[model samples]
Target chain A: GAGVSQSPRYKVAKRGQDVALRCDPISGHVSLFWYQQALGQGPEFLTYFQNEAQLDKSGLPSDRFFAERPEGSVSTLKIQRTQQEDSAVYLCASSFRTGRDGYTFGSGTRLTVV
Target chain B: AQRVTQPEKLLSVFKGAPVELKCNYSYSGSPELFWYVQYSRQRLQLLLRHISRESIKGFTADLNKGETSFHLKKPFAQEEDSAMYYCARSAGGYNKLIFGAGTRLAVHP
Candidate 1:
């Protein structure tokens, strides 16, 4: 892809239903990050992957939230037993170098849990 | 804890008028500050970072350590500048960025 690509631009889930969102970062980008953005609020960090290793998951709201970047190029954000609070825009971003502000963001997956 | 603050939720300005969007932060150690913007139905993109002192699209922001402020300023505002702006901060060694609540700027022609 020319840029970061996120799947299922909009998602509708029933409460307690599991859902998976996918993100394809820019080719060869070393750093990948996931963020959650509520209405009228800025994006909040959820997890970060420096390659195939998930270095940071401290921002995950709960144990139900899980993310993985097994091969380092494509990543998945899985939410088990989805709750109403999980409704938000899940954003994916990739950067060429670590600790740098140069990042490109995807269109984001707007998840709506009913 | 590191936090970024964008006091105004919305700001309106006339074309060719000066525009300044205030940003403040609170972090224990040295922090890197950044500004991101999003236009209508578009993805968020980085505008600039404090690490680079150069201006972009006629906008420039300087990091003031003592005051813990990174205010973005432009001498002349254009209607094309209307968008939502966000302030972000990250502590050294941590690649995670904490963003502020964001401000929506409206430049009228």
Candidate 2:
């Protein structure tokens, strides 16, 4: 792909419903990251992956938040029992290396929990 | 804990005026600082990093260790420069970036 790709650009979910956001990273990129951006705020790190390995997930806000990149090329973020506070933009980024090389961010998925 | 701080939520500048977006950080060890910009309805993109020490689109940022600041500056602001700018700091080693609340730059003609 020319750049990182994310699915379901916008989503509306009722509180307590589950939502899945997908990300297709640049081919062969070694690092993938997920971030959450609240209204009027900067993106906050959610998790990170190196290849197929889930290296870090310390940033995931709660047990309800889950992310996976089983094959390394594509990733998904799943939120269980979404709450109104979970409404935000979820961004995915890819880097050729460990992100010291800079990142290319996707358009992001805007999730609204009502 | 590593954290980035961008004090101004909004900055308005007339065309050709100088522009500066303040960024500061708090990290225990050495950190990597970067600036990312997002145009209206566009994806976020890297503007520059302190490690590169290079200017892009007339914007430059210098990392000040003593003050823990990495402020982005442009000598002449253009209308096209209107966008949301984010300040980010990478935890040492192979870590993800921590971003600050963004600053919206409005460059008016």
Name every residue pair that clashes in candidate 2.
none
Q: Write the residue-wise lDDT of candidate 1 on B1-109 in tens digits.
A: 6788999999999999999999999956887889999999999999999898879999999999999999999999999999999999875465678899999999998
Residues B1-109, candidate 2, lDDT per residue (tens digit)? 6789999999999999999999999956888899999999999999999889998999999999999999999999999999999999987467588999999999999
Interface RMSD, per-candidate values to 1 decimal: 1.2, 0.8
Query: TM-score, each model?
Result: 0.97, 0.98
Write down the worst ten-residue block by lDDT for model 2 chain B. Answer: B89-98
> Each model's C-alpha lDDT?
0.93, 0.94
Residue range A1-114, candidate 1, lDDT tens digits = 799999999999999999999999999999999999999999999999999999899999999999999999999999999999999999999988785856899999999999
DockQ of candidate 1 is 0.78
Q: What is the TM-score of candidate 1?
A: 0.97
Against the true structure, candidate 2 reaches a TM-score of: 0.98
